[model samples]
Structure formats: structure tokens, C-alpha cells
Target: MKSKNYDYYLIILTSLILLAIGLVCIYGIIYYNFLAVKPEWSSLYAEYIEIMNSYLYPFLVLLLISLGLCIPKRLLGQDILIKSSALILGATLVLTVIFNLEAGLGFILAVMIGIQSMVLIMTFRKSRAVRFEKHGYVVRLGSSLLHLGLVVLIFNFVTLRESPSHILIFWTGTLLITAGTIFALYPDRITRLWYTEQ
Candidate 1:
């Protein structure tokens, strides 16, 4: 029988792309609003923000589409719960775009959190070895932390539009990225030593 599993490399590549896009979006928003404070750069800042806003949602939608393609259909399963969750998440994202309502965005964020949590739970339950294996753990940990950073970012978006929130988002994202890099590059011996009890 043909394997039902998707290529792990493909999943990891796509996820890394998604993470980069998300970080770029966050950085653009932060830079335009806070760092581009010079009087002369006002027009440039406005132009940049305008261009980014115009393309951001469409890019996100495309990312979701690509992610769906990358994920194995069998893994998702044909179930009422999965269908309902997908429908609700899609509707919430559409509402967020149309109304730009905080509640709608919050709902979308909540749905994302729920979905990521479920994914992580299932992954851990099925693949304890993957979670601990040096290379395998990098993929698992990087993806999980990336999802968590994205969720926190969505919260940062919905909450007060202040420096504190921006700082929080930046630091949280940076931390996730930094940790993922370390996990990916460090020697297996170090990872094993760190994770294993003496």
C-alpha cells in the first residue's frame, strides 16, 4: 500500500516559510509604526504600510492553502469536529478581514490556538521518540514554538496597540526563533544531556 504520510522535509520547509512570512509581517508593522519616526519618512512609511496591508491577508490565505496541501489528508480525518473547526476558523478569518473587529480577530486567534494545541497533543502522544530524538526534536520543537509564537502574535494584534504589546510580540517571536535555531544546530550529545535526567 502507498504511504499516507506526507514528506517531513516538505512540512518543515513550508512551516519555516510560514514562520518567516509571519515574522516579516510583524517586523514591518512594528518598524513602520514605531521606528520610522523621522518627519521626512512619513510618506515612505505610509506607502510601506499600505502595500503590506494590501498583500498581508491574501498571503496568509495562501499560506493556509499551501499548508493544507502539505498536510496529509488522512491525518486530519473526515470527522464532524474537524470540519466544524475548519469552517469556524475560515468564517472567523473572513469576518476579521471584513469587519476588522477585535472580537472576530480574537475568535480567529482562539481557533488557531485550539488547533495548534490539538496538533501538539496528538504529535506528542504518538511520537515520544520524535520529541526526544535530536534531529526529530528540532522539527517538533521548532514547529510547536513557531505555532505558539504566532498565537501570541495574534493576541498582540488584538490587544492594546501600544509599545508594550509590540515589545512583547517582538521578544516572544525572537525567543522562539532563537530556541528553534539552537535546537536545530546543536550536537545530539548536548541535546540528550540537557533533556535526559542524570
Candidate 2:
């Protein structure tokens, strides 16, 4: 008798998923900064840089992927209400791309980022809240907020790079990370404010 390799299946599936998302995140961070500033590489390929800096291609791909995810396989089996809505959304995305509708594209991009940000925050809250509580209340709350702040600060660096508030964001993230680390390492112990002789 032979057994199914479920462990391998899970490992491979998780690894691929993580790599896919991580690669895109890395690319966006690096390329967006590239678009923000013209170094030797951008200067060398000025034509290509100009095209990419416009952001149409990346926006099209991202919008397509985001809207495409709406038409789930389960929805395909459902009644017209759900399926029609999905179809409408799909068609809207297609038309937006075909027509190069600036407003629609911008709105969709905002929606995509807003939805993902909400999900990301919820994920951090749900997963970290419990784990941190195990250590202690002060550690849990302090560390979780600090970690979230650190992430938000980093996100600002990426998206709000136009202002170049580098010093503030960098220090904020560094402080958050440091405080979170301290909270994580702080020992869990009982404390007494005043001792009375029994």
C-alpha cells in the first residue's frame, strides 16, 4: 500500500504561495523607488524607465488579478444574482483595461489596496493578539502595537516616498521594532508593590 504525500503537498503549496507574494512585494518596493528616482540604471534605459514610470502595465496586471479573483468557482455554480455580479465586475475590469479609463483604474487600484490593507491588519490582530497574550498583558499590548506601528511606518516609506520623510519613518520603525523586541523578551513574573509581614 502507498500513502499520499500530504506533507509534501502542503509544503510545496505554502512555499509557492509565499514566494509568489514575496517576489511581487520586493519588486514593487524596489521598482517604485526606482521610478521615484533616476539613478544610473534608469538613465541607461530612459525609454523603458519612462514607460514603466507611467505605471499602466503594472496597474493593468494588478487590477486584472484583483478583479479576476472575484469570480470564484463557487460563484460560477450559484444563481444569477451572484454570478451576474461577478460577471459585471469582470466585464467592468475588461472594459476599464480596453478603454484605458483613468478614473476607473484609479478607483480600482484604491479599492484593491484598501481591501488588502484591511485584511493585513486583521490578520496581524487575529494571529498576534493571542500569541502575545500568552506572555503578559503589557507585553502583549505594547509589543503588538509597536509591531503594527513598525509595519505601518515601513509602508509609509514605500508609498509616501515623495515627501522623503526618511528620518522620521526610519526612527519610528526602529523604535517600534526595538520596543516590541524588549516586550517580547521581558520575563513573565509576579510583582508586589508592598510586602506586609504575615
Model 1, range 1-198, lDDT digits (tens) per residue? 122333455467668777868877887878777647867785687678666755565455444434433332313543543465577657867787787645555565565556565555655465542222224654565555555555656556544457556886768767765765565566475458767965
Clashing residue pairs found in predicted model 2: none
Compared with the true structure, all predictions reach lDDT values of 0.56, 0.46
- TM-score computed on alpha carbons, candidate 2: 0.35
Give the number of the best model, judged by TM-score.
1
Candidate 1, residue 25: Cα displacement in angstroms equals 10
- Superposed Cα RMSD, model 1: 6.5
Evaluated at residue 86, the lDDT of candidate 2 is: 59
* Model 1's TM-score against the true structure: 0.55
Clashing pairs in 1: none
- Model 1 is weakest, by summed lDDT over 10 consecutive residues, at 65-74
Runs in model 2 deviating more than 4 A are: 1-135, 185-198
